[model samples]
Target: EKSIILLPRQNLEICSRRSSRPLPDPRPASLPPSSRPVERRRPPSSPPHLRSIRPSTRPRPPPRKSRRRKNSATFRRSPFSVPRYRPFRACPRTTSRRCTRNGDSREKSSEIFTPSCVIDFVFRWGAFVLTSRLAPSPPVPRQGMPGLGRGAKGTVYVVTDPSEMLKVLHNEGTHPTGAIQYQWPTKRWLKDVRSHLGGGDAPGEDHGFWGDGPKWKRMRTFLQTDLLTPRIAKGYLPGMIRAAEYASKGAPAYAEPGRFHIFSSRASFDMFSSVMFGEFSRMANPGPETSERDRMFCDHALDAAEYLFPMMSNPRELFWSAVGVRTEMYDSFSNGWKNAREIAMEKSYAFMDRASEDRLEGDFQRRSYLANALRRQAEGDAVTREELAEMGFLILSASLDTTSALVNWLVLHLALSPSTQRTLRKELTAAMRDRGAETLVPEMYQQVRTLPYLHAVLRESHRCTPAIPINVIKKNKASALEIHGETIPQNSSILLDSYSVGWDPEFVPQPERFRPERWMDDAVEGRKGTLRQVLDHKMYQKPFSQGARQCPASRVANFEVLTMISQLVLDWDIALSEESEKSVRSFQDVPYYQGTTVQPVMPGFSFTARS
Candidate 1:
């Protein structure tokens, strides 16, 4: 079989999971040679504020170091630690073939990978069993469906043609927008207690998903009311800056030899926690009650998250079909739920109380999203206290995972494509200079808002490897998505698979390659008119989402990513991990086949600070 096949690879003409491929190289346009050619040493100039710091003002305790050590879990080192993997709450967007957890995967999953989900009243659906597991590209598209092809996700998908995809998103297909039908899970599978992954919730209480579709809908509304505003996002900048700083110059513990990373999976997780939750996390630097609380909460949350997301078409059906059991993963899930409930409840109530008290006392701040949520709740919008909590919870969970996922890819790009990295650094440096500064602190914040190169990097990173492989999934309930001329059916979930469109040659010339400049100007080296037009036109719909259901915190996410990159570029000269960067063998578990939150899957690279 040919090494590469068209996306959404079904059982036909597919290769085995053991197959390996190379990692993606950064596009030529984004990183200019002039930028990468030169090298800089000496740490990036420290924040002027840090340099001016004086000795500690707090009085030190007398040397009473004789205290005996207690159980380590007694105090946590950080505030934001949560169980990293949750089950059904959020599905992995990009799934790959099975292998040892080492993440070495064949780079074959396509743009619209769909898990094979079929329930005849009840049964657990294995996400695997794709075309790679079966035959070849020799299977052509079915006549009526046009563009419908098979791959990992499902045997038959909607349209494979990029043009048709856009039409669907714009409501143009005969199938119409919102025409897809979603399915309910099976009863037999649900009857099996082993399949249930319950979490840390009070016995018999409705923890969130233990209810109905209306609950989710209201929670969705609550999220819309509070999180999407610009005000809240602006307040979160400090978190991104802090995380970026740590990444560029890591803690003393992990900064070792040739492949040490200032920023790793941990950094990304921590950064997001700090920004979204304020200072309440226990993972910041554990060793207290907060630490223990944070750990238990995160772990439990992940456990619960696991069973929350199953590709059964209808999540509600699955929950009701299966009785909550106490299996190992279920126990973990239950604990996670308990923790998530506690945290979300605490934060949600606090937000509501604060916002309410402020308003009642005639001391409310200016208009903002939180106020909107409050208003919705007041107007009987079903924006319950728990629902509000879920909103904050989603921000923490979604933003962090997606952002970190993208960062992972960015690091891989830098390591494999030094030239591209250098070029980006130059553009960034020029932007900094234009701001009349050589330092890496306060002023840089302002610089990020205006830098074209910085924006280019952010956009290009997304263009090449969307932080979340799956675009927003919108379920059309009332009716089908009626497009330009056609009418899609009701109850259909329409997904604008940005991955497919991003790789489409028409929208993006040489779709597979990375090209930041393509977004800035027309394709220079034998390509199309311009990538920006495609992006701006919302080609095949945006990965970040659009309209009412778009990502509320996009602005903040963008700022955080840009700031992190700016600081990283300013602070260090980085390259891919020596082992993983080798061109001969491709990276294992690259973006193409990851399930849900699929992102860059490479190791840390070598780095040295710029003086």
Candidate 2:
């Protein structure tokens, strides 16, 4: 629910003074609240990203005269899951080598983590670990740690106190930090897991986006000097609109509507892939020639995800160099990279290969940003072939899941609130009429930033059910600092409590409510309670991210999501599936799922043409 911004200097100073020692042993979940005041400290480096959360020095205001609510009501913890991994679609966009039950084990783990946990954790943690005991047979459990609730088998716990989750990355906070059993570091994770970071592995100098020191400075320099600016991102608008049209119908039917499970995901995949590739291939029905290529790219990404799922639960020594299985998970992981590289080089390199010789724009000034990226690399921008491979894979993986989730949620939310849908449609109607846009063609396109209602819908959907429902890791330079009186040792991991942020009542009035109006008011509701996730919402930052390292593709993604939903809103009416309606009525229910994006699980809806 939250990305990061800079924490104030006072807050950092407090964090700096408190962590001179290792953290204490884990505390009971029901441990009594701390009585001491939270002091401030200086963290290891310059101020870094923080939730757009406004800090309060005074005691929070009491509930209104209408009624008071219990704190417990506000802090309903989101359910927990088993193992977590950086999704295969992450920056590296490949499965972790430890995706089987043959990876590292903790003293506490015996049985492998549950598949539900495996699925959930993989979405949240970016990586999860397990032992051989995870096989169908029962195994062992860790000492002193009693299972918390149902589904507590041999899972691992990363302590997160919301406020100090980043401290864990530094090993200065609670719990212990572990390794990314399926690490793609190409080497072990070299950047300080606890230090504020830039993507060192990002194929250039370390400091790419957010500023830290030299490494981060270089990153900022390169991106700013090259195509990373907002203007350049806006250049993709034509392609974005083209992608939406293609999803509607064109080349090979993208995730045929009747295919159910693959529908939403394939559509978004097409959209994102088009963005990365600089053109939309008609997704009507893959011709034999392109079908294999599509699978090699998208399918490889998902298959890579599935293949690693079970094997990762098995502990490491178990894989044992015995079967001659190397520490690297060549079977599941390597294939994705291998397949992705071949296809990307074939398709994208062809683009690059051709663009490099074009007369007009020297590739760098070409309309296609990717072509420009190749040109930059050629002109000493510091990117390598390996980085480009991951960049393409990341394009598929990251864009696929998020756009799919956003579209599905948009429709679901629209279906449930006819009035809201009506309001939204009115806006789209006027915009379309005013723009006089013709047949939403493949190449004819425009921007949508001025669409206020559209922005609200996307923000509200993100707030209610964030695509990522849990932690985001941050590593900083120097040593770790303390936060909220807890000592965050260097080299540890921290869990950013997004679930808590979304539900914090003090920040959003009627925290459980889904009102977009809170953001419309200018002054952010006048205080701490005013912050919300709505675009105009005082607390609203780009849901894509906040601060320096905010996602580079956010602008393009925003246009794609808005345009896709706008087209649908103007063209179709989404009605709830009877089953989905029934489940929405019940608190304990699951919906559809598109691969790992965890959607309405089986959400059913009928789309009717609307005038």
Candidate 3:
């Protein structure tokens, strides 16, 4: 027999039953004394604890409904209950606006941080970074039209075919040129800067780099006077050679681990500063002490590289900016361009002031780009100070990064090949001796420029790794463009694929090999395979691009690169450091797309002075 115990104080009943069926009632089995069935006394055979209990037969009571109202007030009074309804409230750190769902007011969306937003933001940038590190090519997908892709600004058309690239770049009328979205951060900073400077919206007065039609033509014309002309470029050679001599001395000693880029970047800055800024250049009074301005410029110039790609690839930048949420990345991007612009404008205003006072000194200073522009302005030219400042910023930007990067790549290539260095030195020595110059001088430029070996080396390096791999252009025509029998929609973005085109086996035989001799005019490795023959019969090397929108400073850049290479070869013997070699086995191993330029992750090298 089963025992049963009913405790009135506890309002509970404990009992053991043999029935297999579960109780239908949800309430407790306890009952009032009158309603309870007649209880039988416990038998003596049972234990002492069981002797006090009694057996009974009774059914459980029916479940009772909640008497209190199930409202907001009732939920608050109960310690265990959570509020089912949330009062409508303004979004955190956002404007006064409430969100509603199905006629019920709720907290604004901005207050809640959901998993989806975090996942998207992380995935977008994380995948991009991971793919860039592991993949051999760019992270972007190649689909749609023949070479279609996408970027932050618009649709990307990567034209890898040499013929197609030429067709797109050459047809400027049909496809108006535009700056790469890689420069989006810089452009955005400049806009903010102009507003602060009270240079109110001049809707039609876009700068030449981004503007098209007559505006672009006018800006290019103004720049051509100082940059494109061979005569003026030649005038800067003396200062350039002096700068090169100083740089050659600054090379790291044998067995010392030093970054090739640091050596090249500092040297390029000094070279351009002396040539472009003249007396205003920080390097004018070179000493052991580093200038605060120079430090700021160096530290911040390449900071964009780390921030730009993420900003472009991730759409979250737009959302944050809209909500006035200034992220670390956005701030970094802004600061880099802001500091650079500050320095550029400072130098520009100084140059303007000096021009007004007729205080310009030295031959280089008098013939400097700014002085030339100022003279032109005095002679009825309509160039404004803001325009002049923008040009100055561009010059500074090029010197600080792109030009230096090219120097780094060129030196890296030479460092890997000792024979190439020796060959280059011999060429330089012959060129200098031919002009009866014991040392490198401006007089030997004509001979040095014509050296077949030097030209071959430069071309080979550029072919292997161009400073700017993808040249961006837009199809501005109203009608679609049909190329390779594929129709490219109107206003499609085109990327002249320099890297892929340079490496294409069909266009370049043994494209993977860094053979400078392939560029030689009299190369015996198949006459048709030479760069000269190809240029004559088929496509252009296009390192500086082609057509009306090609880089105006190409001539200036080539001269600077050649001068530095010649000096470095004659002065020091360069080789890759042991640590650097362990990381970078070949050109393919280097990381691509550092700040939209093809500047690789070059670690360091050793420089031994030549006997």
Candidate 4:
């Protein structure tokens, strides 16, 4: 027989046969009262094995009182919610690594403070401090800090004070070297490109623009004696004048109403080709076939210059090549050099043929730079065909872009300043009147140099718009030198910031204004007073650089610029077009800075023939 049993307050029932042993309780004592198992009646239809395991059917007990206090808002708040508290105290110098509250040490503080984390924090903050110290500052500093600043490459001592700059340049010792070490990359890339294109073997050594030491000395001497001398530079004036006239004639047809760089480049090409090759390119009026060839050749040369300059300035770009990784920059330079080599070779061979024929005539040819070089070669000079080609390439590259840039700036400046234009035109008119010639003859072009105002305008323009803003880097060859009581380390790269010197208010008052009169001498008390101009060449105005490594073509470049400006101003009434005028005004408040040079952004103008 089976019997049902109910324990007091337990609400549980158990059924067992008289002979069967009772089962032990399955529920543990730790369960709360509400969760404790309760007895329930088993349904008759349930299986026999499940009847003893039926779920408790007793009603749940009432919920016991909550242990937490009865604050409805606080009870519902998140356990991890941040509490309102006062700001932490400032870190003490003695115990900055530890955080304390009420002078009690907190657990897990050691985990938050670790050596690696401290080191990481230090490194990150240290880099920020160092970068702030080394970054380039504005031309005029807000803090009135010293002119000395640090660059990524090296120390840059900007000497805006004219007197200080004069002292530094004047004391630049013999065998002075510049900071521009582009020759290495240029030579390497040129060789690689030439080899890839099967354009003869690599150059034997760096010479001309690429060389230093005795080889550079010899080349410099040869250039100074043969082509760059004032006498030789004067001889090229007629050619320059004719080139200018040719350019002026074609300007209206080729130049769009406002755009003029293309016209300036063609004019520069014509002049440089005639003077350097003794052959006229007539680039301004080329045949259709020749026109396309000229365009391609010029594009290559320009592309080479654009890429090579930035690459040489940054050493990281060339580091890839050191690791045997060829880059697009390298490839671009290679193609450019290859094309330049072809152009140089063609011109060199033509010059050689002319020289050989001229030698048979028993009369020396010294009319053009090429003829002068060939004369030196015929006279048993040490210059070789290879050197001639190299020199030819250098001259071609240097002359074309630099002269074109100068002409562009000069024309733009003159166009904007109507009063300055009137003054310049009056000077030219007076010069022509003195010569008693209505037309500008070759002699009149030469006489224009004597005009004080014309030369002043050129000087001011050069000061305002230096083609190369930073003069080529200079290095001390022998030992450390002292300038302004500062010792520059030996073999250290020296950079003269020509832009700062040009714009310094101490030397050039009202520097932002275009005032050519500052360069003119005043006749005081029947004698020429101290000219307001910086009289010493070393004192100011190093547009073509100065000292031992000064540019050899300085005189030639000056003549080209002067002749072109005079011709254009005398014959044409020029002004900035409406669009260009608006562009200039936008940037007028701040000084203009462009790539590797200081130039205005707007490059367009309108020209009308003077009645």
Q: Give the number of the best model, judged by TM-score.
A: 3
Report the backbone clash tally of model 2: 94
Model 3 C-alpha lDDT per residue in residues 1-611, reported as the tens digit of each score = 00000000100022222111221221113322222122222212321112233333456456466553432110111111211111111111221112211233333222211111111212232220101101113212222221123444233444444555555654547325655323444445556666222221255555434456455556667776777778888877887887788767767632233345555667777777766766423332246664677756655665654455445544455566546577766887787777867776787888789878988887778887778888887787565777777777666666656667678778878887889998888878987787788778876665434587987887787677666544434453455665555666656666444343344444455555678887676553455654424332223353555555556776677778888888888988888777666655555444332343445445467777788
Ordered by TM-score, highest first, the candidates read: 3, 4, 2, 1
Q: How well is each residue in 1-611 modelled by candidate 4, as lDDT tens digits? A: 00000000100122121111212222224323332222222212221112343343565466566564332111111111111101101111111122122233222211111111111111111110000011122221111011112333234343333444444555556545533233445656645644311122235444333446455666666666655676667888777777676667655553343236556666777777667765556666564434455566565665565454434333444467668677766776677767876877676776688678764222222487877787787787666777677767766776666777678777767876888899988987877788897755556545434677877877777676655544544555566655445666565444444343344343455555677777665521222342233333443454666666666777787788877888888778877666545434311311221222332333346778888
Q: Which residue runs of candidate 2 sit more than 4 Å off their true CA positions?
A: 1-228, 249-261, 284-291, 307-330, 357-366, 385-390, 436-449, 504-514, 522-550, 578-588, 592-600
**Model 4 Cα displacement at 529 (Å)?**
9.9
Q: Give the Cα lDDT of each candidate.
A: 0.40, 0.42, 0.53, 0.50
Best by lDDT: 3
lDDT of 1 by residue, 478-586 (tens): 4455432345455444443444445444455554455666655333233335443445445333245544445556566666666666676677776644543332122
RMSD in Å for model 2: 17.1
Better of 1 and 2 by TM-score: 2
Each model's TM-score?
0.57, 0.59, 0.68, 0.67
Error of 1 at 224 (Å): 3.4
TM-score of 4: 0.67
lDDT of 2: 0.42
lDDT of each residue in 97-170, candidate 2, tens digit only: 12322234323322222222222443222233221211112222111111111132323323223323333334
Q: What lDDT score goes with residue 277 in model 3? A: 64
